[model samples]
Target: MYDLHCHLLPAIDDGPADLETSLEMARMAVADGITTVACTPHIYPGVYENTAYGIRAAIRAFQCELDQRGIALRLVEGADVHLAPDLIEGIQAGRIPTIAGSRYLLLEPPHHVAPPRFEETVFDLMVAGLVPVITHPERLSWIETHFDLFERLAMRGAWMQITAGALTGRFGKRVKYWSERFVGDGMCMIIATDAHHPRRRPPCLMEAREAAGALVGGEEATNQVVIRPRGIVNDVPPSDLPAAALRTCPRDQRNANGPIRASVFGRLLGRKTGV
Candidate 1:
């Protein structure tokens, strides 16, 4: 299997703290049947501040280390890029690296709110000949209420990636509920570990694949984790994707509760609460 999103590089952003831990994460990935992993460290300016050249260098170093240790897993260069006003400029300047040098880019939206003109930004990316793969929309609170936004994005040539843990209920019941809906609706085009460590949030894809298979069928699940990811890394257009089901999620399967409620008072008190 090819994992298109993971933060396994040492000392980069919030990934493994050191090389030893990174190697352990690789071992865990291999045990989970992953052969290729894209080292997608966060590329948030003024925060992670990871450039394309630096990510490439880090991937080369990690690849050499894996080779020295006889680990068969292959590391590829990429970034989980935070959306910014200068995103197109950064890509044009080669500051942002696409997935394995493909036209596919892993685009991360802000967790708390969808940026203004988000669809237009994605449209601009497509116009610039880059495919923006939106990461982890199921975890975003606003998307639960405005699901048509995601469907519109899909229609505008954007892709969605669901985290493996979210599908398997590792994040929580809320995230899993949405993840299932996305997969069932064919809005989620890929499933990746988004692994950050060896254990908690470990590199595990098979469990999620099995869970997805129960909804979409085994072959379709394989395509999500294997075929589509391989195509992204190899710069090929995704093929044999599961056809969108004509049936929407049953009413009973839909969340009865409304969107996650965030309190302005809680924010003023410096306390965070959600359900």
Candidate 2:
């Protein structure tokens, strides 16, 4: 399986503090069936302050360590980018790292509060050519009041990701409810381990996959971990993958934000290419 969002780099943020712990996380991920993991650290402005250059450098060094120790896991570049005013500029200037350098990126909204123009920012990003993969929206503190906003975003074009742990009830009842809703409603496209530590937030997705299989069919559950994630890392257009919004909810499969010039994601690509 492919874990498109993970905090595996050492001392880079709230993740592991040293290389040993990072290596141990890698082992845990490998054992859990995640062969490829995107080393996505936080890019909160004054907090993490992680840059594409620094993240890539850290990944290269960490990957080298893994190789020396015979760990088969592959690391790629990504960032849990907080909603910033300069987001478009950062991506345009190459300061922000997308998943595996693909056109898709993980956009993390503030957990505590719902900011202004949140939906507009997400739409603007899709128009600007980057597919905003909203990370772990099910766990957002204000999700209860923003369910309609989320549905609108999904209908428009944004991709939503639910954390793997949330599906297995690691975060408690409310969070698991939202996660299951996202899965059963076909609002979430990916299930990623936003893993921080080996125990506190370990890199595990199998339980979530099983839980998803129970909610959705086993095939759709497989798509979350294997098919859709594989397509994103390879830069495949979103239309090519199974439409998440169309699974159980037909309303979101169409353009909720007016007309589209082409396929939901093909418009971003300017062409139709297949995997």
Candidate 3:
């Protein structure tokens, strides 16, 4: 499998602190069935402060380490870019790194609160000809109340990537619940491991894929974890990618008023569960 989001670079951000830990993480990923991993270190300006050039250099060094260790995992360049006012300027100046230098960018929203003009900023990035792949929205607190915002973003050509751990209840029951809901409702397009270490938040997705397969069927679950991710890394357009057989809840199982809620093991197939 190809993991499109991971923090495997050493001393770059909140990932591994040294090369040894990074190498260990790489081995863990390979054992977990991840052949390719995008080294998406955080690019928060005042915090991580990772520039495109620096990220590229870091990826090169890490790749060499993997090669020397005889690890089969491949590292690609990317940034978990925090939303900012100067985002467009940063992209224009080539200071922001996209996934594998493709048009796909891993855009990370604030976890505590939704930023002001969030929709406008996403649209502006789209207008600038960049595909903003929203990372881990199921973990966002405001999504429970403003879930429609995500549907709108999808209509505007944005892609949503849910963390693999979120599906296995690693973040919490709430995040896991929403992750399943989003996948069933067809809002989420990819699953990635936002892995930070070898043990805690480790690089793994097979278990999550099995969990997702129970809802969307084995085939569609594979599309989320493998097919779409490969397309994003290769800069493939959404129309050209494979379609997911979205499963919906039975009519009697749906809620009457707002969103349709699915049981923990039940399918919420094609129905539109409102925000």
Candidate 4:
């Protein structure tokens, strides 16, 4: 499996604090079944200004460590870019790091609300010929509130990625519901760990798979979601879902502010229940 989002770089952001921790996280990832991980530190305007060159250097250094340790996991470059107006300009100037240097960019939106400039950002990415693979839309306020917005973005050719923890109910019940619903409806194209550490935010997608299996009544659909995400990073197309099988959250269920009430309930309940 491939962990599309992670803070594995030493002291870059809210990830590992040192090289040893980074290595330990990598080892844990492989042990938990992740083979490739994108070192996506925050790259919005103010949070973490991780440039492509710096990100590459980090990946190279991490790769060297992996090689020295004889670890088989591959380290790739990506940016968990925060949503900001200037981001589009950065991408055009080659300041933002694409996933594996592919056209796909891992975009991170604001935590509490969807920025009004989101559509414009997508337009900017399109203008620069970059395919924006939205990272962890399940956590975004926009998707939580306005489910149709996702369909609109998908219509605009942007792909969606859900965090592995969200699938396993690690993010609470609302996230699980969103993740499962999106995967089941074919609204989601990839499932990544988005891991940050060995324990606090460990790397694992088993819970996501379990949830997918339960929802889809089989493993094929769930596996398809997990496999295609890595394929996108590797420049492979995802398995196309049949029109009839695809689903969208009911209009009434979507949130205009952020997550729907069900999601809030699920999350609250999940927190209360704990993992």
Tens-digit per-residue lDDT, 1-275, candidate 2: 99998999999999999999999999999999999999999999999899999999999999999999999999989999998999999999999999999999999999989999999999999999989999999999999999888877887879999999999999999999999888776788999999999999999999999888876657778889999999988999987888652222233543555212222234223542221
Give TM-scores for every candidate, taking all chains together and pairing residue i with residue i: 0.87, 0.89, 0.89, 0.81
Q: Return the TM-score for candidate 1, rounded to 2 decimals.
A: 0.87
- lDDT of prediction 3: 0.85
> Which regions of candidate 2 fall more than 4 Å away from where they truly are?
245-275
- Predicted structure 3, TM vs. truth: 0.89
> Which candidate leads in lDDT?
2
Candidate 4's C-alpha runs over 4 A off are 217-226, 237-275
Residue 204 Cα positional deviation in candidate 1, in Å, after optimal superposition: 0.5
Clashes of each: 0, 0, 7, 5
Determine which window of 10 residues in candidate 1 has minimal summed lDDT.
258-267
* Model 1: per-residue Cα lDDT at residue 60: 94
Clashing pairs in 4: 144-258, 144-259, 145-255, 145-258, 146-255
* Cα lDDT of model 4 by residue, 1-275, tens digit: 77787888998888888998888988888887777888899886666777988988888988998999998898888889877667767876778878887778888777777678677778688777777878888876566677877767765667777787887878888877888777665566667777787788987766665666555434334543445655667765332422112332355754565222222223323421111
How high a TM-score does candidate 2 get?
0.89
**Which residue pairs overlap in candidate 1's backbone?**
none
